[model samples]
Target: MDELFKGIADPLRREVLELLRKAPLNINQINDHFGHISRQAVSKHLQLLEDTGWIRIYQAGRERYGYLSKSAFYAFKDWVDAYLQWGAHSIDNDHGVFLDDTAYKKGMPLTQPVMLQALLSKDKTFDGVFYTAVKTTGIFCKPSCSANPRPDNVIFYDNKDDALKNGYRACKRCKP
Candidate 1:
């Protein structure tokens, strides 16, 4: 997903992820690792990581702790593995795979364009008809959720189980 790619694409955020991979760290502790960068900058990186599902932050009284999300890491790994497999087996100069309408439409209730439209409008009419998963947030919501996910970061599933199987969490707000 675009958000997963964007999350690890940043050098600084990657460094932070490397740190969290070793063990959970509190806010001040994570900040200490980057002495050259202001604490605010470090905090912003942590926020991005959390938003993109690379990390999860939880409050413990006064101390907030951060930890890597293994599901997120595994999702990224699976994506890379698929890409590597595709590249390795490709014929000379071969690239791209295009699916025709029948292949693309075989099992969907609503077309993608309509799904995007329904999602943007928060149309309750489509609730339970399909779910929209926001890649950046790693959460899926019903069409009625009060969310305006960017079209590029959205993935649609006829059922929530597919979204969960692909490593997305149900949105607490919508309980989808």
Candidate 2:
């Protein structure tokens, strides 16, 4: 877990993970996403991500492709789940502490309007940040998915499991 945290501490590494989340990319393709960073620097970050099991590298001929390893996040997810349950129970207790329930009731925060605009525009920049689930179709997709569902019928989830927990299936087209 320490290694995982160290590996993801760098903003560049996090960006790499976001890129990999969309699809596996060879080093060159990954480099294309960041013109400001050198190939060597990106390679170094990739090595760290791979060493920490956050990503997997596949070599086909001379090309090496980096793929996001979702299993690598299981430990962190478990930790977060434990705390989330604890927090929920604590919030439910009628004690001195008071909290806002509007965001929770909405399934997300007020910034959802911005997310919806990004979804409607098929913004690749927000690909890993959130997922849009269409109530009518009962399917969730990555922000960059080409399918444009009605914005009014959409709800956003921070991760695939959350969408799944809410009974939304993965989009066949985007495979969220």
Candidate 3:
């Protein structure tokens, strides 16, 4: 658990995890995502993530693939869920809802255009990061929501409250 926390502590490692969320990639592919960071640094981060069991690396012929252990995040999610329930009745301020600072610093860029593309592609990588609200239907949805809405009628919000505040209701399908 300590190593898991330590591995996820770095912004670069989190970014790597996000990339892996989409699909497994080789070291070279992962390195391509971070042009500013050297390959050596990326390798070290990948090693740490593997040690923590957040990712699994396998070799197929000469190329090595690093796959995100999707189940590994469930433990962390359960821990957070417990805390959220514990504080459910006591807390204000949107129940601790907030954007990840590391994501912003690392250029996750939840811009409208970027989000629209993710929505069109049904990108699961951005599922919990933002909600998309449709202007025409007045409903908000998760990024991976199957319901298709025109890009012109969509707006992205950082939290559910923001979507609600903007006159959008939660989408029944995605339950955003």
Candidate 4:
């Protein structure tokens, strides 16, 4: 997790990931996108990405192409979801803690506690950021759902696809 976080810590690295999303590219093709940076610098970024398992580098004839690894991102998501789950369980969701828009949207939290708080308070700002999965009910809800769930029974997922894959149906109330 630390390696993955460190790998994506730089804006340029993140952009490389974004670029790779469109299509796989060799070092030269990737370096061409950033005119100001040296190819060596780009190589370093590619190396970092490769080292962190974010990308798979392979030789197609003489050219080496880098492709994004979906599993790496899934792992990252799982880690964040776990963090949110821990936060939701560790903190009191009713005190209005981490419920404020600034707290959840600042690119930091603000996930589990904020997610649970959003679920409890029906905060619309976090609707798509994460989904609330109720273990006992076997249903998932958008953060803005009108239904009130016990925080202890909730597991947070960053994507609705995950909730669906996990065999949890979307709630009738939220239609998430």
Best by lDDT: 4
What is the Cα-based lDDT of residue 34 in candidate 3?
93
Which digits, one per residue and each the tens of the lDDT, describe model 3 over residues 30-95? 999999988999999999999998999999999999998866798788878766774343243242
Q: Report residue 3 deviation for candidate 2 (angstroms).
A: 0.7
Over 4-90, each residue of candidate 4 has an lDDT whose tens digit, in order, gives 999899999999999999999888889999999998999999999999989999999999999999999999999877656544632
Better of 2 and 4 by lDDT: 4
- lDDT, candidate 1, at 102: 37
Query: In angstroms, how far off is 152's CA in candidate 1?
Result: 32
Off by over 4 Å in 2: 91-176
Q: Tell me each candidate's TM-score.
A: 0.49, 0.51, 0.51, 0.50
Candidate 3 similarity to native, TM-score: 0.51
Who is ahead in TM-score, 1 or 2?
2
How big is the positional error of residue 105 in model 1, measured in Å on the Cα after superposition? 27
lDDT of each: 0.81, 0.79, 0.80, 0.82
The ten-residue window of minimal lDDT in model 4 covers 89-98
- Model 1, range 30-85, lDDT digits (tens) per residue? 99999999999999989989999999999999999999998898998998776566
Residue pairs with backbone atoms closer than 3 Å in model 1 (clashes): none
Worst 10 residues of 3 by lDDT: 95-104
Clashes of 3: 0
